[model samples]
Target: MIYIYLYRLPPNSLPRMNKVILVTGANSGIGLALCERLLCQDRQIQLCLACRNMQRAEAARSALLVSHSDAQISILRLDVGSTQSVLKAAREVKQRYNRLDYLYLNAGIMPNPQVDFKALFKGLFSRNVIHMFATAEGLLTQQDRVNPDGLQEVFATNLFGHFLLVRELEPLLCQPGHTAQLIWTSSSNARRSAFSLDDIQHHKGVEPYSSSKYASDLLSLALNRHYNSQGVFSSVICPGLVMTNLTYGILPSFFWTLIMPVMWLIRVFTNTFTLTPYNGAEALSWLFLQKPESLDPLAKYHSLTSGFGNNYTQPRKMDMDEDMSEALYKQLLELESNVRKKIEEEEQDTRAHGQYLNQTE
Candidate 1:
């Protein structure tokens, strides 16, 4: 059985003109679903889809246009895994919009994921079955690689790139007298045990995806601490066990199809089995209409679906501390400085080489 959840804004709560919202990985899944929900609530808002592939981005735009024919939509080419691409996209955003109202950091990756079938089967008979299924704690692992930016691919794509994007667009996001929301598509798998302060990129860990997500949770708290006075608020959300392309990569489609009924049965025990993308995007769309000051910085909002097919958003306290979050923030700032210096040096070298070649010619 499929469940559909519909949301409508109060008549007085409709958005004003020139409210700009940008979403990374907006081409599909929860990100795309969030976009559609946002448009449904407020058609006057300017929505920008920042995706790595222009072709997929165009297709997504067309799909959205089919529903809201008069909605204003724009596309930006952004690969959050690549530093250059992120920097370039930030510049484009600055040129196009004077202020950004919401920045959805949703692009993420879990490369070469492998399911531990033995562990899964073992957990099925154990008392921790529901917890295991909800968080995928011991049942999944991934073979992570380093991106061209010399950072772990999972960390770069999931956490660091979004951090860099926030820093690049700080002027627009931190404007006085206006509040901007930084909503991250975090996960229930963001366990405190998975993350290490000594290795923020999870260089020596098998669960880079989990570590990166934990890092994001910490970073959101840190952002709230430092930027709340400047009107920038950061919040993270767990989309539950949504069967997106990322989830499909873990197990076969037929297997998930076969277990569809079982998943629904599991939902009675735990609301985390929000299997569809639209259901997973519940908390994301909910945050769009909230007052930032009323939200708890340390809480991780979750998308939940009841067995009776009711959808709602719940705020759960994350397993994190202010001190650790601040430390991670400082570390990220240092890393950002080093990355900028390295890029500047490389750019200088490239320019010098080009001039040398011109002289020789």
Candidate 2:
């Protein structure tokens, strides 16, 4: 990964007056880092840090205020793994900001990973392999149970929930004059082999996290194709590997500590492993300053850092299939419609009961 600065902002000249940006997974890691950097660049930008834990969100806000006292930062509780939470979060955003300028979909998970280091080493030495797919690619993992939405937790959180949120907020997102941009925090770990049209949810013994991320990358491409003409542009980026809290939890603490030195050495060769949260967040921050039409909607951006720590964005080869993306899109549409109908029916039932009681009174 080479540090190629596609574009850069002059200074504190970010157009913050008319832009209200909302970022999911903003309590910590790359999400929080992006929020901080974006705010420093332009304190006038209103940033909504969407997180599941209100307490953590408050803590993050307090920390941001230490340096950026005038930054307009707020929190909206959201859990991308849950459909109910998604709808509730969207309603809150709509109530707060009538028009959204940028929506950074960065909430994701990789639970209970079981990576075969033997296979990894073998692949590393193989003729076809250039580097170890240690960060986000060529990894396999399983998460917890299916969500209340009756979808795999990974798929629901990483893709479906975000999809529902975008659909619900379409009115605000599709504002005229290139007003809105959807940036998906995708990964190089997203492999085409992990995804199957016959089993998009990974109900079988498949790795849900990798499959879901790949689905998301494809979905992002499909979204740009379907919605770009309507003023909504979608882009995906693979933030080269970073040592985040989420990654630290995947393996044993002792192992991570012991391997810290080796990790540093690896960083020298693999520029994709940005090594710090700040560098890992460069793609999201870069997208914030980019003009809508200048962005390549179909290409997945790679956030890379040079050996000397300069941040840049590189265009990565995305394995996108329109037919598969369309199939997944239709399936999600049906699922969203069904869930909305069920919620509406429940509301109607409560209303009917109230009316009957009123009549009896």
Candidate 3:
């Protein structure tokens, strides 16, 4: 059930020159936490909760309004995995908002995540245990499928759909004298080795989520090269190992609850275990306060927690180069064109079949 809540503010109700921010997957987890933090930081900004589930979106909006009675919040149905949904939501955004300030590409999926207990047991004794737990390298796998748009599920949801939205909204983002920022919620599990230009969709790979995040890192750099001159900046962030629904998928909540003490102990050695969603949203909330122009194109911002539980944002140079980023950008453009053409052909065929049926009748 897709529902578009029309709570558009009257002319006088609009905040004086307030920024309009859109967050995808703003219903729960890190996305929802980021929204709460943003509203707390600036009461005047207009927020649009673009989510796949309308009920959850409405609930999230209501909860936010409880603390922020004067804030302007709207909801739109957006399933980033679907081509039709992305197009419709982009249209809605352009229609409803005069300008877009920050576009958070935070909606993603790790469908049917299965953790390898065998590898987990071996990693427990290895010197690379910290890295293993941090990256989940060979320990996690997800079941992915093909979407209606004829792309791999994880690729379409995490990367391709967001790519299309940016392209579609380029008019609002890439202006002559204004600036807009694209912030992606990447993960510590993002690995360079998991991604392959040859198998960009990871149709035969096990770590599609990691592959998607790495692609996002490359795409952010490529976007800087392509659109930085047009006044649009892109950055990536890692929320560390947050125990959100995504993490709950890795290990059951009860099991995680039992191991909470162990995780807290391990947090001393590797602050990547930013266990709470609020702590996970630290970098995302920090990025909102930054001057987009001053950010590094190749650096990935991280949300880190200390042994004392202090939160801070840190920027680390990604293991990507300009050449590879450019290559990825070109490839994405090609795929975008191809996918559009394919969908057009399908629509035409459906129309032709309908016409033939009507003629016979």
Candidate 4:
């Protein structure tokens, strides 16, 4: 269930003196690790955890407080897959903060993921073993379904929801003389062929996760083109191969248990096998401290862990074109209009149903 908060601040409460950083999916994995790293780096940040699960969000807040007792933190319920949820959360954000310094679009999912072990085993014998491990190219797929809003679940969660959030927060993010950043947790699996302009939702593809991530890269560029002059800069990052709940779903627990030794060995060749969430969050944490102008708008920052366990960030150019990115952006706007119309209609129907129930009672 979504968490709700009444707007109340104590007279003794202090205003935020440091950056206001908001992270979606902030309760676990890379998102949680990134939060911890941020607080460790600076105790003054006003951190907001935008999560669908309030219980987990509170648990994560308690954990962060344990590490830094005086760190500022708040919670908001946001399910990026739902239009009503996103709209509600956006409204609450405007009420909660005066400015949004950093927006981390870090929430995403890989549903019903399947790994092609036959190809995985075959790739182990090939010269591109390192490439296979780094990109998971042709090695993974996921089942996709329609959300309640009649949009592709993976697409809605990973890309479109954040797109709407940015649009809603424009007054805070795109104002003159005020700069804000949009940092996304894109993936190494994002491929050129995985995404299609005509099928932006990837409804016909098994790799909807990959398609959505690739779309994120394009959308970042589109955002830069449209909003940079307005002071909102957009960037994307790849957390490499982090072993999180998402990863656990890709293969069974026993399979991962059996491959622990092999994975560590493979880590020697490709540092993308960062494995641990903290190690995987290097680039995300790094970007938190950067000047937006210093980052490449078209590059996907990767978190890499060395064979000896040191973590670092690297930026690699993404395979994207401005023409395609702009086209995709326009399509997203059109889809946005359609969804908003549907949502308004749904709300009217919901109220009508409530009235009928009341009359019957």
Best by TM-score: 1
Residues 70-96, model 4: lDDT tens digits: 989999999998888999999999998
TM-score of each predicted structure versus truth: 0.94, 0.89, 0.93, 0.92
Q: List the residue pairs that clash in candidate 2.
A: 136-189, 137-189
lDDT ranking, high to low: 1, 4, 3, 2
Better candidate number, 1 or 2, judged by TM-score: 1
**lDDT tens per residue, model 3, 127-205:** 8887887889989999899988789999999999999999999878877778999999998888999999889999989
Error of 1 at 267 (Å): 1.6
Order of candidates by TM-score, top first?
A: 1, 3, 4, 2
Worst 10 residues of 1 by lDDT: 11-20
lDDT of each: 0.93, 0.83, 0.91, 0.92
* lDDT of candidate 4 at residue 240, scale 0 to 100: 92
Q: Once model 1 is optimally superposed onto the true structure by TM-score, how far is the C-alpha of residue 201 displaced, in angstroms? A: 0.5
CA error at residue 30 for candidate 3, angstroms: 0.4
Q: Quick one: how many clashes does candidate 3 have?
A: 0
Question: Which wins on lDDT, candidate 1 or candidate 3?
Answer: 1
Per-residue lDDT of 1-361 in model 1, one digit per residue for the tens?
9999999999889975568999999999999999999999999999999999899999999999999999999999999999999999999999999999999999999889989989987987888888888899988889999888899999999999999999999989987799999999999889889999999999998999999999999999999999999999999999999989888888888888887787788888888889889999999999999998999998999999988878999999999999999999999999999999999999999999999999999
With candidate 1 superimposed using the best TM-score fit, by how many Å does residue 314's alpha carbon deviate from the native? Answer: 0.8
| Model 1 misplaced stretches (Cα beyond 4 Å) | 1-15
Strongest candidate by lDDT: 1
Report the Cα lDDT for candidate 2. 0.83
Rate residue 139 of model 3 by lDDT.
92
